[model samples]
Target: MKYQARLSLDVLFKFIFKITGLLVLLLLGGILTMLVYNSFSFFLDVKPLDFITGLAWNPTGSSPTFGMLPLILSTTLVTIGAMLLAIPIGIGTATFISEYASPGVKNILKPAIEILAAIPSVVIGFLGIVVLSPGLANLSNLPNGLNALNGAILLAVMALPTIITVAEDAIHAVPKSYKEASYAVGGTKWQTVYKVSIPAAAPGIIAAVMLGVGRAIGETMTVLMATGNASMMPTGFFDSVKTMTATIAIEMGEVPYQTTHYYALYAIATVLFFMTLLANLLGEFFINRFRKYHAA
Candidate 1:
């Protein structure tokens, strides 16, 4: 009787899990459908090539252009800069916490890093505006520090907690046997970490970095507040630039529904969605490769 009851419960839980998974897929499909449906009209009016390759985004001009190249470039610059700053520092910190820290130090450092993630984006933006911006402006001899560099710095800070936490978990999850084997072979701690532990954790680290990229790319409030909102083609990190999320936030409310401008915003959103999706897919590819290598 007990065995029958257990089997029934298992079936019920399996049915519930399947239903939940289907619901998630449905939700994602619904979002993609909505974006495509709204943006379809805009693409009809503007050649897809022109919209993507054009440099101007003057929606209120006499002729009104809807080029997205600047926005795409700006987002790419900020995301890349942020990753360059965060990845090395985040991974190093994770390595220390996982491999070198004493129990007490680990307890203190982990919670402090995690707490950083809980801080609101608006608060971080405020700090960028008041603190980091002025410092950079002075350092770079710019009038103000609100530029791609400032946004990248802010995004790096925002992404750090995620990268560190996930990477630390990944590093910690390396089997004790692996480390012991390295030590038994007369490898130093650093050598084992560099050779065995990091290699073993490569898949997780890649996923963590990709997750950080997603966070940096999709962030709205901090970039909006700090990135000066300039729509011009950025020449360097010192140049003020606007991101797609910032553009959408700035214009979506005022844009008339069903207009070309409205549709263009949806198109930008679709492009942004695909960029993030591509990042995740690449992460998955690397993860599979690492898993296969390790398995062999």
Candidate 2:
């Protein structure tokens, strides 16, 4: 009787887990469907090509325009800048933590890095306003400190913890036997790390970087606060620009509900959702490819 009861409970748990997974998928599908429906509604009134290629984004004036090119360019520039700034610093810190740090140093530093990830994005945005923006203004002689450069710097700082943590784990996961063999062949510590461990962990490192890119690009408040929120073509690193996220965040509340402007925000959200999804899919592809290669 007890054995039968235990078997019944096991089946019940399995059924619950299955339902949980299905529910998550259903929720995601529901969200995607809603976004598509609303965005399609907006497209009925506005041509898709015009929306895609438009350089202006005045949605409230007498002659309101909805060109998203500037917003897209701004978002792209900041993401690229953040990734460029963060990748080296993140990977280097990860490598040091995994390979070079003494046990005592590692113990102290790992938690410190993790704590950085816990810091609020709003706080980071405020810091950008207080500390980073003023410095950039001084360095560049720009009238205002807030610009793409400021936003990129803030996003890079926010992304660093995730990249460092994930890359460190990947580096640490490199098979001890690989390192042993490299050293057995008389390779120096640096050579073994650079040539063997890092090579072996390349897929994971790439995935980590992609994930960091997703985080940097999707960030809203920090970019909104620091990037001057200009709806213009970005001319340089110092140029003020507005990202899709910031546009949505800033306008979603003030716009009349169910208006064309409201639907446009959903369209922007749809783009963001797909961008993050693509990044995650790319990361998964690398991870799976690495697994297959390792198994082979």
**Candidate topping TM-score:** 1
- Give the Cα-based TM-score of candidate 2 against the true structure: 0.95
User: Which whole-number lDDT from 0 to 100 does residue 92 have in model 2?
Assistant: 94
For residues 1-296, write the lDDT of model 1, one tens digit per residue.
99999999999999999999999999999999999988898899999899999999999889999999999999999999999999999999999999999999999998899899999999999999999999999999999999999999999999999999999999999999999999999999999999999999999999999999999999999999998999999999999999999999999999988889999999999999999999999999999999999999
Stretches of candidate 1 above 4 Å error? none
lDDT of 1: 0.96
TM-score attained by model 1: 0.99
Report every candidate's CA lDDT.
Answer: 0.96, 0.92
Candidate 2: Cα lDDT at 77: 96
Top candidate by lDDT:
1
Clashing pairs in 2: none
